[model samples]
Target: MDFSQLKKEIIEYSKTIGIDKIGFTTASTFDELRNRLIRQQELQYQSGFEEKDIEKRVNPALLMDSPRSIIAIALAYPSKMNERVTSKKGERRGIFSRASWGEDYHLILRDRLKKLEAYIIERVPEAKCKSMVDTGELVDRAVAERAGIGWSGKNCSIITPEFGSYVYLGEMITTIPFEPDQPIEDQCGTCNKCLEACPTGALVQGGQINAQKCIAFLTQTKGFIEEQYREKIGNRVYGCDSCQTACPENKGKNFHFHEEMEPDPEIVKPLLKPMLQISNREFKEKFGPLAGSWRGKKPIQRNAIIALAHFKDETAVDELIEVMNKDSRAVIRGTAAWALGKIGGETAKAVLENARETESDEEVLVEIERGLAFFK
Candidate 1:
């Protein structure tokens, strides 16, 4: 197969498969992107895994059983009008990080990439392809860069002049040696918007962001997060998009997602009270396969309580009371107690006392007391 013809065929096939951009490169796009990953790992900013995890992904042999070439794809997740509602004046909003504001990209990207692979095999009966979207062991951002879809920004996200860093990336590892594209030159010269805007200072240095300090990781993280990081989480109920929001390059770009990715109005901009009231069963019914459900309702519910506390919305006091008094989960009870203190009044204090009397979790009792302390 001629590389030139294969390049044209790959691009055409990707578009047919619903991917917005497609590029090809060798499996070893790791070397160019290693510095950023190492810097984040060294700072203990990485989440989910350590330096060893990244090393495993970068290893082409591991990325694919026997990787030879990469066919990278990008899905442009352009921001919508509802996604930009960040002001304090808005009514209690269901806070979906930009990524969650649409259909789960994993399903969308996966189905499309799989179809593309099937198409390739139909053309070349012996061709084998493995596809991934934000998963797998390969360094996707680096692969995307090599494919000419975008360049890596200081925030460690791939940036395309056409779409900024909002693009969701996926890739196919295949033995096909399709013509590879030249990598783009970095365009984030002297721009520190992503660095300056990080709440936890995760973007500590030039083009370096600590994933551990990243709010998105915290919100999506399973199990209890370090208490110290909890206070810095802000109002993001799911993921955090602050750095991407601050990037000048992202301004004025419009994306029309396919219908599969539209945000559920109820979940798109959720009311704080309803989010708190939702049962685990209801949460699964509404968001189970969606992006935020991966961590279960606990983190998101806890995050809603924190957002209520941040807003100091007295109206949420009754709901917070219910959670403190009735929720079986200790984390929910504790966060509710904490939120009540922030919304303090006679009613808030009463709920805290009730929780203190009956709560079994020692940690929750301690939080109930701490909440009472704020009132005194």
Candidate 2:
């Protein structure tokens, strides 16, 4: 069996299935990634969402029996919305980062991966394969980088020359010993743009990040965001794209190759006040298709309250007050109270003073005081 010919065949078939870019690499254990991850663990930089077992994340042999190669694929997503949402002064909206704009990328990548898997199975019935997207144990960036899909960028994203960093990455570990593709040279040289652009200074240095401080990670948290980051989060409700947007390589690199990845501007950039009032069912029905909705609405709503505060949107003060006074969740009520303070008005001040008297949760009371302190 000529494995090289088979690898060439796989690449051709991948293009037919809407895979924008595909590359192959030997599946030997990722030594460099293991060292980097260990250092990340030492610095406590991990987001807590990653696979806890570091070995499982770096060693392909652990994920599958006798893994010989990894096939890495990148699907480009649009960096710009094709249509524009009307901007009105009194109406405020929060932005979901470009990555979350379209249909959930996990499903898109998984569907492509399933197709690739089936193709391989037909060609080589004995071929064993295991695939994973972002949630998988193996680091997608590491696989893509080694597979020559892209160079690992300073923003911690795999940046393809054709697609820039705006690409969704997934990989398959297989028994076939496909010839490896050469990795692209790291071209980020002397450009400190991504690190400099990070609002939270989450990019501690080039190619290293403290995920705990990243706005993208913060927006996904269920608890109260620290007061310092609340202001830095700006109008981003789902994720942060500042670092990627700042990259010189990414300039003018927007691609809408996959229709499923095109965003509906109204849904991805919906009005902020309505988000504060969204019922769980309504939130699901409206945002269920987008990747940003995976963490559910609480985090998005919390960030929306922060965005209102960031905008000082006087129109939203009343809705914020309702959330502050009536929302069942302490985090929601507390975030609303803080936003009310930030969006300060006589009504907001009066409500905060009254809520201070009635709010039971200690954390909510602390936020209420934080809100009231803004008046002084």
lDDT top scorer:
2
In candidate 2, what are the lDDT values of residues 46-115, reduced to their tens digit? 9999999999999999999999999999999999988988646679889999999889999999999999
Compute the lDDT of residue 76 as modeled in candidate 2: 94
Q: List the residue pairs that clash in candidate 1.
A: 45-212, 57-137, 94-269, 94-270, 103-261
lDDT of 1 by residue, 1-376 (tens): 6767867876877776678888888766476456766766677766754336667666666655656788889888748754444334435654778677666888888998888888888877777788887866776777898888898888878999888888889988987767678889989999998888888887777666677778888787655555566667766788888889898999987687566666666676677778888877998888776766777888888888888887888878878887888887887888788778877899888867877777888988877887898888
lDDT of 2: 0.93
Task: List candidate 1 stretches off by more than 4 Å.
Answer: 32-39, 49-52, 82-91, 222-231
- Residue 26 lDDT in candidate 2: 92
Please report how far candidate 1 places residue 156 from its true position, in Å. 1.7
CA lDDT, candidate 1, residue 146: 80
- TM-score leader: 2
